[model samples]
Target: AASSGDLNWSLNPTYTGCSITGAVGSQVLSCSLGTVAGNTTLPVIHVQSATTPADCGVVSNQATVATTNGTGGDSDTANVTILCPGLAIEKTADAASVTVGSTIGFTVTVSNNGAGTATGVDMSDPLPTGPGITWSIDNAHTSGPLSCVITAGTLHCTGSLDAGETQVVHITSPTQWTGSGETEVNSCLGGTDNTGVYDNTAQVSASNVTGTPNASAQEAVLCPDLHVTKVADDASVDAGSPIGFVITASNTGDAPATGAFVNDPLPTGVDWSIPEGGSTGPLTCQISAGTLTCSGTLAPGASQVVHITAPTTFADCGVYNNTATFTATDSPQTPNDSDSTSVLCAALTLSKTADAASVNAGSQIGFTVTASNAAGGSVGTARGVVINDPLPSGTGIDWSIASGPGNCSITGAVGSEVLHCTAVDLAPGASESVHVVSATGNTSCATYPNAASLTADNAPGLSANASTQVVNCVIVSPPSPPKQHHPAVLPNTGGPDGRLLGLATGLMVTGGALVLGDRRRRRRS
Candidate 1:
């Protein structure tokens, strides 16, 4: 028997009682047998592929046998098929977990694992299906020179890969690829999508080649984005005054936020308390170690608010910053907010006094106006300190700064009715004064009240008043004229006898007129 084929072949396990001879492509087998009956069963002969290499395609083997008794010879042919080259696909996600409304990048790689090139290789990926989840191709990462398109949310790519070669595509396009095929897609999970595990699959195939099983990758969807803000009721407040803060926490994500909380550390040396019903929504709050913490669950687009109240006196007379932080379960990052308020501690007292409390309305009066900041009761400097004394409408005033450690000046002329003194700044325990002398011009006598006020930056206005009394002057009468001597009148009494009679009459008339005039004058008085 003789055999020949395109592919190298040989007998298996050495057929006993038979001798074989040939190279890989051709072989011969011969066996000795005594006379035997016809149609007898013979030992089976097995043929196998040899080590010599062969091309891929159908291969054939022909064998011919002859009988020693002059029986007819038999010839038959056998064929074998050879296959090579393989196609495989792998899918991968950039992240194992992704937040809602965030982009999810994916990569699909097709490889040829066989020794020969894979022809007409193609890949298809329909992508994962979920609410508001869209897809596109990453043109830059996708293998060049390959025709690819997305049809009805499915990715179709056609190309050829050499042995051990790979072609890659990134499934991240928001829209169909343009002519250049380099435009990237910004596919993202919608904020309204449900949170769960999502899987993506891809497959590869080629002409006359079977591809590996579909490749898959899983990505977990997580949503818990929290935002927080803090707001103060007052930007600036006087010392010893009450202050309030409002804190808000909101969940702006697709999924419900659990175990969400806000933390606020109170200003140093300040005592804070959350009043009853201060917190809104389903939130429970507590204060410990001068810090306030509020915890609750929040659905998407839900928010919680809390109000904090404290006294400004506990903090110094300066800007105080308060911050709050928000955190939640499954939230990769936390958000915080802050607010600043100025605390004013300068406490000013104003006093005005007239030198003479009883000064008449038409008299000249001197006044002393003093403004002081309490040494122990205040903190920080008082800026833009001003003292105003609007005098009576008709009265004229003169003012001068008595003493102060600051840029001080008096506005208005010396004789003007209005007196204004301004001091640039005044430190705690500092004082400024102004001496004002005013001429109360002609006016009805009466008791009058004079007032002065002081104002400083961040400090409440203060006013003080002093009163002055005016009275009418007393009247004095002149001394009476010397009275006529009666002793001289004795001579006049005798003279009334002769010529004295005429002279005496005149004198008597004169004396009568004088006495009448004196009585009239006394009545008038």
Candidate 2:
């Protein structure tokens, strides 16, 4: 027979079972059997421990059944083990700011915690998108043994991380940014542990992480601009005189400008001349149909200069205007600039002539004086023009203006008179004439010389001369009739003898008639 006693049951803290009446390492239970059958089993006891243990080594739990009837005690033990793996990842960017049409780089680093090695590690980074921004990846990764590739605008990487080991992946944006404002870049890391435990444990998972360590970059874009100026060396010039112009073109933008050129229309009434050596500065310039074109290349904040020369052809007095326009590859519709100049020149001429080359003394002679304005550029008004006609000093000649331009005054008298004519204004291509008459004085047969002169403002003086001839006639008287005296004396003697004869007179008459008849007959024969 056996007396009633207590049995003790003990288990490891890692295990749990139905409560026994006692503290740790000292639990007690009463044992009794109502009926003993052949090979019948006592009331069964159970114990259990968690599948995963806090420590990675083997974990154990024990239970002992002892009787106070002075019999031996029996014990049983159970074991379990736990596995853990951790992974940590971080991503960073190379540049904080970038310009349009420029690139940016990114680097990703993955680290492992000391619990266990992480296997089948994978990383993904989606590129940012917006207006004016084009994103692309430059797979230049060299940080670790991980291989990185980009597809569908997303960067994908694959590798493994051992305990306390790390791997790296790299990505670059090779396209230019066209948009503005702040852009966000997000990435994620994921994998599984050797114990088949996923890293999707919590917000900060032991193996996988999402939307962390985002990098931001910036971009800027700009446009090109330009400025132009035109000027002339001389503001006023004479007709047929050369004038020089200097034109400058400049680029005010950050980029180089191609096909930069300036177009200038030649001023009216001006003739174009080839520049020195057929070029000005380094510019290629040409003039066609009264327009001048100068072309060259210009860089940012760079300037080019061109020179042009032309001669004035207008014959009228007025202002002339010239303009130039500048253009470039990047810039269009820029404002143009202009410059102007004046021309001043005049030409005058004088001439004098006589109506006849020779004149008779005591006859009227005519003289003519003319003034002309022959300027080739512009019509010129000649002022204070005077015509001086001084008759021959000793030729006994008198003169006065006749059929002339009338604004003339006669000074001095007759033979040495000076005719002064005033031409207030003379237009270009116009002529003025004055006529003077001179009377010759009675004198011996000789040649007389006469002259006239003219002077005017802004013109050279002129002179002309003419001559006249004087003539006299001579007469001779016939010899007196010396024989007539003898006939008169013979007639008086015949009168005394008239008394002796009527008969004698008859005889004398008859005798005279006979004698005259006989002489006439002899001559006829």
Give each model's clash number: 5, 5
Per-residue lDDT over 350-418 for candidate 1, one digit per residue giving the tens place of the 0 to 100 score: 888877977644576667888887775326556677888776433333444444334444566544456
lDDT (Cα, 0-100) at 237 in candidate 2: 62
Q: Model 2, 440-522: lDDT tens per residue?
A: 65542356566767665544557766665553311122333322122222332435333322121211233112211111101
Which stretches in model 2 have alpha-carbon errors above 4 Å? Answer: 1-14, 17-222, 277-283, 314-319, 344-525
- Best candidate, lDDT: 1
RMSD of each: 16.1, 17.8
In model 2, what is the error at residue 471, expressed in angstroms? 18
Which regions of candidate 1 deviate over 4 angstroms? 1-17, 22-27, 34-59, 66-74, 80-97, 100-321, 332-340, 354-365, 373-432, 438-477, 484-525
Best by TM-score: 1
